[model samples]
Target: MSVMIYPQGRTLSFVYGDERILVCREDRPKVTSRVQIKVYPDGRVVAAAPSDIDDHAVLVAVKKRARWIHQQLRDFRQQYEHLIPRQYISGESHLYLGKQYMLKVIESEDHTPQVKLLRGSLEVSVRQRHSGNVKTLLAEWYKDKARDVFARRLDAMLEHTLWVSERPQFRTRVMQTRWGSCSPKGCLTLNPYLVKASRECIDYVLLHELCHLAEHNHSERFYRLMNQIMPGWQSVKEKLDGMAHRLLLN
Candidate 1:
């Protein structure tokens, strides 16, 4: 079959053997001086090109870096070792605050379904011995903890960010490819699964989004602000990315 030609601003793909490398094309002639390719930790390859460039040229650039892109994808996929689909049964391991805790499920006739961290284990008490109930109970517990943790971290991060005067409205949601995001209106949306990482990592993600309040895009100014706020953010980001699959495991 012939390859399909993607539009200028649409997502494209470079077929590499059995794996298809997704290419996200960004067109910005003034801001983008040249074609620059960046592979995110989530295995997303983005190509920022001048508005004048054609889709074929961008695909060629991605093809040139195909070897490197494959390496990055391999590394990220290796992090998924031992992190399979969760059964939500007893003896399963779960993460809380960068620590692993074995899941302990208990069925009680008179008690309500609840989740608690006790003695290095996540104890889930449910009236029925169903995995769905256990999963729901655990999700609720994580959401509550994430709300409190994200709020506190956001407050602390604001002190260092001199650009943001008033605190932005923030909320939690379950995200597949992002830890956090700042809207054009300055509202921050964080992933509830982020609470599974360490406090330092959490702060890093919050600060990244807060920087968006000052600079919306990943421009040089945005990175400069990120460096000014946290010099070692790149390393922290690497650490978080290294364990993302485990933290996001269901």
Candidate 2:
């Protein structure tokens, strides 16, 4: 797992029965006494605690809520039947722009491997009919589409926020647990699988990264800015979160 530590805090772990839970601890200056514990869909437990709180206290707090965390993780895992591993073969369902398309694999030796969306189906023309080639072609196709879509969405989102004057450098990446990340240098790395989500979901992620251009951290002021700009972001986020399992299936 990638190490995610805040500037003011370090990573910590606690034993919950037999399972060891790793916590990404963040020491927020604005946090007074309450420790905010959030369990993400990726099963990462993030604790935003006061700067004065020590490692032991954080551990205790996480241990106290271990059962709840397990329940949340269980719910996330069992909520979707389609969460099973994707076979990437003909007749399998694939998602693009929040729409489901059946996979139609064709073995054609005369042409190079290519992926195309045609008549409610994702058609793959490959020289060899195998899972690996189909997977790679689909990934490349998604990456290509994401580049165009994200660029257009980014330009459109910039008009909504005045904080970003120029378009930032952005690239597509396949991440295990995150949809996107903005570097300290303002470069954006987005998950290629994000294209499987809807336009509003894509905009939410782009605007979220753009918000970081103004507010570097997830502070109260940053959320306030988000609320002002996207009033229904929380609802949008929930919809995206609900689709994470199916979207992130390998």
Candidate 3:
């Protein structure tokens, strides 16, 4: 599909194999025209073409660089091993409420594995001492915590937010990119991964989405609403974004 990105330029989305690349035409002045391709952590590719170059030429350039792009993406996924194939082993650090805690695995006759926080560590009890998916235990615990925390925070914050006739419904989910999203039907979904974030960051995300319930877009008015409700949100958002690389529960 094509999008009218500028007055005289357009952007295209190209799919090679299973990967979708965003071809962007950027206006550059006082510099040599060039095509620069970048891959984000979320596995999205952005190909920046010179403004003067038309969409047809940009497609040609992207095709020529497809081999390099594929290689780079492969290397990136290899480097970001933390984002996948989580090893449920002892001594690895995990984040909870913005604090790092070591994992301590304990085996017992009780078959059902349970996770608990004690002495700045995640004490996980498992039935099979030899092998089993302990990651499931931790993930289940985090999901429950995410639901509880988001509900309580949203309840307290909704009172200070803008107009609403009915109370919004809340749910927890595992999302790849966004931390949370608000539906038009007053249903707010939060990322279960947020269980690892600080209390302040959690509040910021919930309030940000709550503001969206009123404004629905990040316009000046939306930001004004955010400022009026929660002043120090941008900083907390930045901090939360920074945790994406380190706080992976895959």
Ranking by TM-score: 2, 1, 3
Per-candidate TM equals 0.75, 0.76, 0.67
> Candidate 1 on 44-127: residue-level lDDT in tens?
576878767889988888898899889987886676453468999999989998999999999999988888889899999999
The residue pairs in collision within model 2 are none
**Cα RMSD (Å) between model 3 and the true structure?**
7.6
Q: Candidate 2: deviation at residue 203, Å?
A: 1.2
Q: Which number leads on lDDT?
A: 1
Error (Å) of candidate 2 at residue 160 is 0.5
Q: Candidate 1 regions off by >4 Å?
A: 1-12, 17-20, 24-83
Give one digit per residue, the lDDT tens place, for model 2 in 116-200. 8998999999999889999999988999999999999999898999978888999988876678888888898888889999999
Question: lDDT of each model, Cα atoms only?
Answer: 0.81, 0.80, 0.70
Q: Rank the candidate models, highest lDDT first.
A: 1, 2, 3
Better of 1 and 3 by lDDT: 1
User: How far out, in Å, is residue 93 in model 3?
Assistant: 0.7
Output the lDDT of residue 125, model 3: 91
